[model samples]
Target: MKRSWWKIACVVLLVYTVVGGLLLPVPALRQLQETIRNLYFHVCMWMAMMTVFTVSVVNSIKYLRQLDLRRDIQASEYATTGVVLGLLGYATGIIWASYTWADPNNPAYASFGSIVREPKLIGTAMALLIYFAYFVLRSSITDMDKKARVSAVYNIFAYAMLFPSIWIIPRLVPSLHPGQEGNPALNVNDVDARMRLVFYPAIIGWTLLAVWITSLNVRLAFIKEKNWLNAH
Candidate 1:
């Protein structure tokens, strides 16, 4: 595949994130220390995932209105890629939390298992499961048009569930995830000026990469669809 300028930009920005995120100075908050650098990678993954999923829902809505299989294809590819990013984000959070929140000498939790039930983690897991079920719904039915319509409706339902899970339910509980005042990711006061430079770029870069991956899948699906139609 010929690389576009945007793809090259994604590579460059990500390279900058890797180098600067490590070498750049960050706020020396107590306990968080060096591990706070996870902000660039972990938080960026989540923000990018959210952006991609939002696009997925928009595509789903288009599919619903036009009953276009191509729109459904875009929706599925973006949702799947977003889920991949969400899983990666969740994994990175666990590693960071284990180091910071579960340091044996000054543990944040009584047991390691407690980390598994983190409010933010639970919220993100719910969102991921809902989309995974979307894929399962698509696979179960043999009729293409019916499958697209039903699953597109489910996609909008999944979108409705997404925001509440990540934003509302987590806020209802006493979470160690730290959004009491407001979501740290969005709070101007919470993120340091220095971190913001790398953080925003990281979000854009990661999202472009996710979209690039989705485009590849969509192209493959388009080809497969064409071949299948010809055979029939």
Candidate 2:
């Protein structure tokens, strides 16, 4: 049987994640044990979010430099995708937390309320909220040129805030999340080799998926704009 490239890629990734994760010996599987399986999805969603946000910021810069409306549109699509991925990442993280930290009934679990209040989660929410305001700002402007130009500027500022709020500030305070103050989730030495194998691919898969979704949205936007132009 034959398969499309994406189908083949998906199969390969799925098999890799499953096989590599499960094949590890019980003693070698890190402290998280089977719970580490969540890493494949949770980490991937975050990777996708970061990739989309980076693209959004780049498009914003290009728009500011060239004053092009298309770049603005591309930036919007990227930001939209990034927000979705970020939400998914947050949800996955929450679920993982519930399993690992929540449900005090289980001796192995910690309190959900405490884990939910972690700096990383709070900071991430603030970052996403800032981007959410970007959409609101874009919608409020009636003039096309003004909307694009103003949004381009705003995007630059918003992207700047994202790093500090989501990455920097979170790391500054102690939290239940993986990394310590001034450190990143990816940099922690605690992550074992088995986790790395799945975590890296999850990032790649999620990023590719975000890009694929953004490309579709861009095409749809172009088609809609062209049709509207013809109608007018």
Candidate 3:
């Protein structure tokens, strides 16, 4: 029961996030309006991505110190999960932008062009692409030890790029995206206290769900690695 407590929490919090995000009152703002409910899903996804990536980098550092193949597998799986969550977050952000940023009077192409040029969007895309290259680097290396060593080093670099690309550079540039001046959802003025109730918990729920998925993947990878070793 103790071991499964977080799994139960993940299910419960996600249900609450969905129900409350839909039904709970949000401060009506120009442009965003009801689309503000996306905060629960879109923002939380990015948060979860950051969490898993942090875990991945930590495991990567452990792999470097201990030279454990198991740690390498764990890092890779966590990174994989982070990439998936990052894509989901990016998709949701784009969808939310189409509704909030697009001018009804303007042509669709014009709206798309503006969104495409957004610094935040571009920065995030760069960050994801960098991680994609990490996987490509891993797959290209035929030697197990060499792959693990090189990929672990590259993973650290990928994580280092995340802060500048997604957080720092985006804020430095002129952007229509909110939270440029400070933490987006954490701002009391931007996100109402009522909304914070669901928003914070949603971050926890999504991150816990990500960790759960990564844990399963790591176990499966270990099994495969074990079987291959035994067969040889």
Better of 1 and 2 by lDDT: 1
Tens digit of per-residue lDDT, candidate 3, span 21-130: 99999989887899999999998887888788889999999999998888999998998998899899989997898798888798878888777777767765776787
Report per-prediction Cα RMSD to one decimal: 2.6, 4.0, 2.0
Q: After superposition, how far is residue 111 of candidate 1 from its true place, in Å?
A: 2.9
RMSD score of candidate 2 (Å): 4.0
**76-184: candidate 1 lDDT, tens digit per residue:** 8899998999999988998898877785875566746667677777777887899889999999988888888898999998788777667676666676776654566
For candidate 3, list the clashing residue pairs, or say none. none
Q: What is the lDDT of residue 86 in candidate 2?
A: 85
Q: How far does residue 105 in candidate 1 sit from its true spot (Å)? A: 5.0
lDDT of each: 0.84, 0.75, 0.86
Q: What's model 2's TM-score?
A: 0.82
lDDT of 1: 0.84
Model 2 agreement with the true structure over 1-232: per-residue lDDT tens digits: 3535774575677677667656754333454657767777787777678778889989989988987677888999999998998899888887788666666575433465567678877766776887899899999998877898888888888778767676566656667677655444477475666567676766666677788789889988978777543453
What's the TM-score of every candidate structure?
Answer: 0.90, 0.82, 0.92
**Clash count, candidate 2:** 1
Q: Which candidate tops TM-score?
A: 3
